[model samples]
Target: MVFMNYSTSTWILILGPLAVFLVITVWVIELLAKAPPWYPAIPIVIGFAVVFLALGVLIRAKLGKIVF
Candidate 1:
């Protein structure tokens, strides 16, 4: 099995969910306020997905294997 370095995993684990929560919270507020329908969330979600995926890839690359 592989493991991520403590710092990398810690930051990713902390920041990833924090960021997602903030973004979604704001998005929901805007949604409830009936903001423009054209303000799609797909891009925001996709952006976060890419960011987290890249963080995962970075961890894997640094550890030289998949992390559990």
Candidate 2:
């Protein structure tokens, strides 16, 4: 019998929901500080997310295939 050091299932279930909740909470707090008509804050949030995600993908792709 062997024991695993870490459980990927725990992270897949727990951390996934936790990460979503944290992002939503931060976005709501930011939007509340901005003003009324919550619509505007949405675009800003989405745009920032998209740009960051794209940058991450680009960086990962470059790193995955490197020749020196």
Candidate 3:
């Protein structure tokens, strides 16, 4: 078995972008509910989530080494 070591800040760096993505997704849902748009929101949101998740992973991999 293998275990990963993580500190508070390290976890934050890894999850921050994902957290932001979740919050923004909620806001987008509200906006969509208030006024539906012609373009499909699903693809856009999916892409946004991908970007955020990638960024979080990148930050964790890079900054995690430097900071912690």
Of the candidates shown, which would achieve the greatest TM-score relative to the real structure?
3
In order, the Cα lDDT scores of the candidates are 0.61, 0.57, 0.70
If both were scored by TM-score, which would come out higher, candidate 1 or candidate 2? 2
Rank ordering of all candidates by lDDT, starting from the highest: 3, 1, 2
Where model 1 places Cα greater than 4 Å from the true spot, the runs are 1-6, 35-68
Best by lDDT: 3
Candidate 1's residue-wise lDDT over 2-64, tens digit each?
334457866576457657766776676567457566467656755776686678556655754
Pairs clashing within candidate 2? none
Q: Report per-prediction Cα RMSD to one decimal.
A: 6.5, 8.6, 2.9
Give the 10-residue window scoring lowest on summed lDDT in candidate 3. 1-10
Cα error of candidate 1 at position 49, Å = 21
Error of 1 at 55 (Å): 25
What's model 2's TM-score?
0.40
**Model 2, stretches more than 4 Å misplaced?**
1-6, 36-68
